[model samples]
Target chain A: MNWKEFFKNLKTEEQGCVPDETRREFLKIGLIITGVAAGGSLLNVVSVVAEGLATSEELSKEYPYKPHYSMVFRVDRCIDCERCVEACRQTNNVPEYGWRTKILERVDTKAVDQQRQFMPILCNHCNNPPCVRACPTQATYKDKQTGIVKMASYKCIGCKSCMSACPYDARYFNEEKRAIDKCDFCWESRLSKGMKNTACAEACPAGVRIFGDLSDPNSEVYKIVHQMGKAVWVLKPETGAKPNVFYTIG
Target chain B: MKRIIILASTLILGLSGFVLSEITEEGVKYQESEEAGGLEIIYTKPVKGVLFSHKLHVKELGLPCESCHTAIFEMEAFKSQRNPDFIMDSLYKGKYCGACHNGQTAFASNTKCATCHVGVKGLERLKKKAQVLEKK
Candidate 1:
């Protein structure tokens, strides 16, 4: 309607009607609801577009699809050489006492009481990572591209939140750096030219550690994971990290 | 009881529709990525009921797999964007449906709107056409 007509209508309206407080409240509520509905409709479109963009196969492909990289430690082959342990220290240049990676010895004496067997232990990089969610500073991030759980040593305030939160004791507080340091799957080394595998996998003389993409059907790691089946059980499966690292559970 | 049944049916129908749509969207991605020869495939589109012609186009165009299907949708039943609007854009940009439908390489986008967005023209007609073609 024209401004003149609108003004005339306004003037003609019942003047003494101070809409009751209840009515005013109702009107305010109604307006708020209307505003929210309008906003939601626009937001829905944006949300749909955003979701589409995020999941679009095109966008997912931009990050070159490397097979889901993972490591498997065969307990039987691991001689408890501490080679993998020492190699990780020397490679990463970890401090004298500080350890980025270490070997845990598990003794299974129920069946064979005297034969105390040993298995190397470290961070079983979980699939549905818990450490990632607990970090408030996002100091811990699982790489969407590589599926590697990475620790931001610089961003870390040495809160020790991750240390306590880790079920596996895989995380250690770097007293020197004043940050949490943990196994990165030797990402820096693997990413370097001509390095086809992680340091631990490469250093193992027995070829006990088989490393490859778990997703690739053709990959040796994938074949072993599927073929070994029930015999291959991961440590702390109850924790539900869906750890990429599987152990030979004999 | 009737109302409950109706609500339950509605929910079931909604879920089925969602799943069916998702399946179709992924299928489109897979078809688009197929290629042949050395000329890279730049795009692909799975027209409604048409058997996705990945290999056919590859041979016809003498194209490579990456050119048309730039995404990793090389596998069967590739996942499409969840949003219909973005799905529309992907088709337009030669990503999902656009991979093959853009005017330059394939049919123009407008020429094939009903392949996806069926308006008043009744999808039944398209369904009938697809059925008849299948019989042949």
Candidate 2:
């Protein structure tokens, strides 16, 4: 079927939230152009063409990273062991007062089965990272190669803007490193040396933390996120950060 | 005079209750058997408020004391954590709790973390219960 026909069907299917006349007309035209360029397939054309058109229209825009490094916390599995925290400290030489990663305990006496759960959190490495924008010196920037949010320690002036701007409370001032420090998925200490996973993920006795390339379909992170009916969600999604870090119960 | 004496006694009782609540014994001395039931181990090193329950392991699972004592863990409650190598890395390498919890013999240590890791909050809850029981 043609892109117009497919969109018309989709519009009908989504009767609950109908778009305005102008938006419908715009979508119809956009789809037609996308269909012609992509050699339209009736089966997967809608999603494929939609994404292709959006990205292609913005010539300056590009995929965040080839590997798109991400992490997922199976929150239900975290035991509050703090092994990941310990490993991150040892691996990165994180000082005693500050932490690059941490486990937040949630307790609800009213809940059935397990009332207590530990949530392991770190730098989300957001696609639209607020920390990157907040940095006056551009000290903290998202790495173009792997999409990992990295710190250029030398550039940091201890402004703490990135620290305050971060919704996840991930960044901290390090007297030792002489800059704002946060989890870079162990990029400098481990990935730079060709290690596959972060120290936290490696140290977790329970498979609580799954770190891998979100861009690679074969990676476990992709499978867990892309699975149908799985409730995968990111932290502070309302902030428009589009975090690479995801969380799920199962 | 009688009303003042009554008020003084009541004040003394309230003060004594407060003092008793504040008093807590430092360091749990390891013992083979006690009236309070099995041991409740709390590890302070590396991190705070990690708990291991002997009651669940022994009573619920029907595992004998020899299953862990003197082998995987020493007789002392917090002795294992005293060693610098007594971390989760050792567990992943099939040491300490990993020998049984390696996903084969038992639920893998990497799975169901809350099952054992009752964090600082859990540890405090257990300690409070112990104190109440001790008072009784």
Candidate 3:
């Protein structure tokens, strides 16, 4: 409570209780236990690339959703064609002022040859979504079966808390809906009708966007994320949202 | 008669036009003199922001105009764009830019996509640059 009472109850450091060698031995044992828990999967053991960046989960702990939906962007292949953005607009009926997905440009003058790159971004549908946590009403929620962050327009109070909470800049307020709206991986448009992929993923002529169930071993998303061949990463990983969308070069 | 002929020639030269490519950030001119080197080309069909720098191919790589012109590309800029067949599929099949970009003569069209595909941002940047130059 108060400073005086807090100081009275505070415990001082108990030094010389354990020797340095003993503490190091305990640490080594802890590492071994963690290694055993990870099942010696090289990517999991090394925690290189996607395993380390996308989530805190060990290999065994991943794919929590029943048919975990995920997306991977082969970023090098993207030319900012904006076809994916257009497809998303028509398919979802997103307002002209709003967007479900966007392409970002990074321009570097010092780089040799090509000095510009385009990056397309959308809802990461994070396993530990801050937006879901910030929603006072049950308006925004992460789906159980597919792990998509969805919005219930009727329940929204237009408080705009979830908009600020999102790390990916994914959510947008729709005036017509009178609520917040976000990318649902086309769950409402096509996936519910047994379509195989999102409108964006299907519309990309460059094969830049790969969308599939992360839990299924046969899926492309699972293969790309699991392999050590190419480095895969998520945006603002330090925020610890555990995003489903990963990015990598072709 | 000579005075009248001179005035007509000057009018033709002015009407022909030339692009004023300023010194890029790398401190290299993307085009040479107003009369010699070709202009910078940006494609906006099928996709946007695909760039073709003549200075890179001609000046840096030392390719003569005949290497692409008359045989591969016509001297006219944006003329190939009129063809409906001018797409990536055609390039992969050893047509147009693919004639040189087929991995043997140069890097393949599929590889290093951003090298030429400057993107929508690049298109906007070029437009902005032109506006800024006009204001100056």
Candidate 4:
């Protein structure tokens, strides 16, 4: 038989196989009338179905990273001292015009308690980074091991596509390096040298930046993110970059 | 003719007053010396490097020289470091910068370690800047 006739025959067989009212009446009278009698057997069927669904669900629920290197900003603690910026510049050999990290001053005279606040910003090191996708030569790509978005300086063509694609305004063109430069969580300068934290996080006198492995349960980053009764959020979450950098009040 | 000249001079004086008021309204004040601005003091006692800006305190915060100069800190630079108690503990005890930086008046001396503590790197930067200024 052709495909249409085969589907018609399959539908007829399915309808004929199912006993209509007798099965419905048995479920209603026998199952509904006896609470404890039918309840245990129904629960077993429900649990079996749930287990089957959970096994299939595990494929999509798996986390992408092993270490999952991430950073968090305790935003309210920042004082706009620019010490983190200076430390980053000195450690990374960043030129005067460019900065890998920066502190943005927000002043509102009408604000209660505090009229001025500072926001420290840097590369978010997103799980789905737009810069990695935008780079034509694969100059900017996420590290497979640590998941840090890093630069392969030689492959960079200075096209500036990654600069435009970045939602956080993180990337800057370096004249001396002749490539796009951004915060690589100090992997090149410090992490490779066995240092535990980024220069910016270490330089923060206010305890503003908390950098740690997100995958580690004992890490400060994981604790802050997983903690209850705390409002932790990421910047521009609607962009779907899945940024690893988190922000909170304290 | 005398009445007309008086009217003309009064008009000129009124216009000058308007112009002078506009200048003052912009918050432009004449400084007696260039040293009154951009003055940085580095502390290297218990810590490697710490920075204090005179412009922020004197100009922005509107604090007078007497607020810190001879009271909380001595007039001489790096003199506080000579004392054995010139550390964060001292600051917490309301000594040195702790008098104002007690978290009530300003940020607590105990908090924001990197804000003032520029570390050894900041000290090197200051030295480089001084060298460049000396060359100029």
Candidate 5:
């Protein structure tokens, strides 16, 4: 009743205005429309929608996180210059022993056409974050708002459980911080300051990393992930973490 | 006496092999030869970790030195990288590696960048190999 109106009024420009379509759709379902969730998302509102009205496609394709911070890589364009790595280090003050992001090189001499491919990887910020689940202290978690896998460093007990829990090997124990450190999609260093893109995305000369709001259909990340022309894949899909990071080729 | 002479000859042959082309632990061939096995050049400018294999171009493709040497590139290695014009944009406009890699003659430089890039990881790998070779 008044709660919906109150929230609607409270909706600042930054949090994004909820489209009338979504509001109407949620209204039709007779659900409170707190938030729309994507595949494997933590929101309870989606379960209600899935129970009656929404199709599987809508369930899977919908953006669960507001601003749905995500990254897509044009891997074919990546030269693995490590410029992104250096930028991330400088921006985040990442130690030499610890890495928030890195490039993995794959060379298959027997492969047809180009035998070398470089894959840049960071925290996937999985909707169903095992690292978050494994953290007894809740030191690492998936933010309900931005869906970024963030670290509450002070809360950490120097546990390495999240390190083993992460399927992408994205987490590392930081001796300096005495905490588990991973990519927060540059939230602390950039996005939190109203910056549009991550440090790595900005540093790439090859346009390999495209970071943006995946929830917004207009965003390049949403279009690339939804597009049919090129293959878009996430690392370790079988792990079923529902990673926000996606990979594509030129 | 015969064994000593044979060993000496083998050492000479090994030394001669270094004069033209040398192979790394990864089997990537590097050379600065007039006939074949051209030098493998790694570019740190524009960006880091771009590898150009002379074996891939001159030896594997069997292209003559005249195709690139003294025309598209100087006989010197990394000399082209010093030129401010030596970049992917210039290649796209039909300069340097772009001369033959323009999709008409060879694969476009824009496509499959990792094929040449080898990246910073590749550069470090090469450096480590150099250090190991020195130890040997």
Candidate 6:
């Protein structure tokens, strides 16, 4: 049968194939059903497309092909000097008991032979952040433009959910301020300085912390991680936080 | 009839996407056990020798994640060394093996053979299954 005739075979004359009153009733039902289906499909398509576009934009911001900069921490180079920690603490005026950044010491004193090794701990600024998930308010978010995991203190209801949920213990609650505080990657200062920079990284005497864009292959942080032959590691990876901070150990 | 075709195609596409993402997310991880227990030393004249340790470095050292590579390393295809010298140059310049044994951060570059090659005899035997892994 021809294509038109083949399609026409799907309907009976009484089932709206003809222009009679009964046919008109069938036609209306069929048209309404068909229209509803088409409209539903169109709406779904538009919503999915919009979601995909938003996701793409967000991914670009987080995992940019070339960001303005990023951060790298050389775990081996860290001396537990607390210079970076103190710098960040004082610069941001972090709470007395709560630290914005800290040094993680991996002491194997039980070994008896090897000297106690120390690993400084702080926010890894992960690529896939768990802290963002723990927050009920979506207060904790990662900025794609700067690649910084930011905490909206105003939106934060001082819930310690993020603090407890974060494996890195990077989140700290400012009891006095009655809000959550975490690393902002020195974003405000960097913007004012017209370049991406971190106060802790700048104050590091051992040059343990290097901050720049990892997306740009030529950038210092990227080169150090990719080409400079440094052994980079992230902390508490079992938590499944894909951190952006790279630590090179000798 | 048209609806059926659309639904079927959508289901197939969605399933394929999920499967592909799963594979991409959890790619192949090469972990060495005492099963491949022999030591292989690839050498360079006038430079130094490269010692491959199975039990000590990989199984021990207790290296954590992102310690050696970035996050995307888990999701990408492996590139081959186009030239022999390319691989050699990487070792010489400290890209992979040079990353640790450059004589500074990890082990010193010496003509000595036993530095990395000498495995804990008990560890090696246990890896060989001649002895069992001890629960220390």
TM-score of the second chain, each candidate in turn, equals 0.37, 0.69, 0.76, 0.70, 0.72, 0.34
Residue A125, candidate 2: C-alpha displacement in angstroms: 0.2
lDDT of 3 by residue, A208-233 (tens): 99999877777888788766656666
TM for every model, in the order presented, reads 0.46, 0.61, 0.76, 0.58, 0.77, 0.47
Question: Candidate 1 on A108-176: residue-level lDDT in tens?
Answer: 335442233345666767666668777889999887777778888888978777765565667888788
Question: What's candidate 3's i-RMS value?
Answer: 1.3
Winner by DockQ: 5
Model 3 segments more than 4 A misplaced: A1-62, B1-36, B131-136
lDDT of 4 at A214: 73
Candidate 1 chain A, run of 10 with poorest lDDT: A40-49
Ten residues in sequence with the least summed lDDT for candidate 5 chain A: A29-38
Ranking by lDDT: 3, 5, 2, 4, 1, 6
* Local accuracy of candidate 3 as per-residue lDDT tens digits, B1-136: 9999999998997797654554332211223334435767677776877778786787767888988888878986677877899899999999999999999999998888988887777777765664565455
The superposed Cα distance between candidate 1 and the true structure at residue B73, in angstroms, equals 64
On TM-score, the stronger of 1 and 2 is 2
lDDT of model 2, residue A242: 60
Clashing pairs in 4: A205-B112, A205-B113, A205-B114, A206-B112
lDDT of 5 by residue, A1-250 (tens): 1222333443222223447665555343322211122232323222212344343356445556787888998988888888999999999999999999988777877989888877888888888777888889988888888889999999999868888777777888998988989999889999889899999999999899999887677888767776555556665443446677887787
Q: Candidate 2, residues B1-136: lDDT per residue as tens digits?
A: 9999999999998886422222123222222234323666656556555667665677667887788778788875567777888777888889999989898998787666676678655656666765675575
Model 6 score (lDDT): 0.51
Q: How would you class the docking of model 1? A: incorrect
Question: Could you give the interface RMSD of candidate 5 in angstroms?
Answer: 0.8
Off by over 4 Å in 4: A1-61, B1-89, B97-136
lDDT by residue for model 2 (A218-239), tens? 7888676654444566654435
RMSD of each: 28.0, 12.3, 10.4, 18.2, 12.1, 25.9
Q: What lDDT does candidate 3 reach at residue B130?
A: 49
lDDT of each: 0.52, 0.69, 0.75, 0.68, 0.74, 0.51
- lDDT score, candidate 1, position B18: 26
